[model samples]
Target: MYQESSFKHDAAPPMEYFLWIIPTGRASDAYGYSQAKTPTWSDYIRETGNNGADRDDFDDAIDFMAWFVYKTHKVNSISKWDAYAQYLNYHEGWGGYKRGTYKKKSG
Candidate 1:
């Protein structure tokens, strides 16, 4: 999340991400300190019953990240201590990671 948003509550992706990253116009609806996408954020709210959570709120952001990490581990059997794998999961999403999409990337 820090790498995604630089710890800024209002961090947003650069214009090019919106212009070219996705054919729809943006990489995702990711925003704020956690850079959480709308669908995932909504899931967090639904799963945790944190209906009032805000992306720009530090506490909410941290809690959202923790929940994502927990879910990543639970759904993917990824060790929480595995930062590299966790990071790939974070960026690629649980399903994407499970599908081994990261293996196709050159980086």
Candidate 2:
């Protein structure tokens, strides 16, 4: 839905605005942040433990989106969940798209 629209449309608003719509925070008794706690992009990243690193630059945007969706939806796979979380954390503050690993063009 949102992910597809974001990826397919060039005129779409920046990912930051879309990400802001998702909530973030923790309810009492919750062990981790929730959609309710995320009010801003920075807040979401901070609460999710994405501290921003160079490694995240190499990941596809779709991968990030899928991981974000999975986290927001509270999916069940521990490995997938952790992998997404780590990726998010690794690439937090960086912006702009990087070429896919298989792309012929060099950055």
How do all models score by TM-score? 0.86, 0.24
Can you give the lDDT of residue 39 in candidate 1? 95
Mind giving the per-residue lDDT tens digits that candidate 1 earns over 11-88?
A: 876554435554434446798999999999999999999999999999999999899889988999989889999899
Error of 1 at 75 (Å): 0.5
Give the number of the best model, judged by TM-score. 1
lDDT of 2 by residue, 44-87 (tens): 45655665611123232343445555553453223445654434
The C-alpha stretches of model 1 lying farther than 4 A from their native spots are 16-25
Candidate 1 TM-score over all chains jointly: 0.86
Candidate 2 segments exceeding 4 Å error:
1-40, 53-60, 75-107
lDDT per model vs. reference: 0.88, 0.34
Best by lDDT: 1
TM-score of 2: 0.24
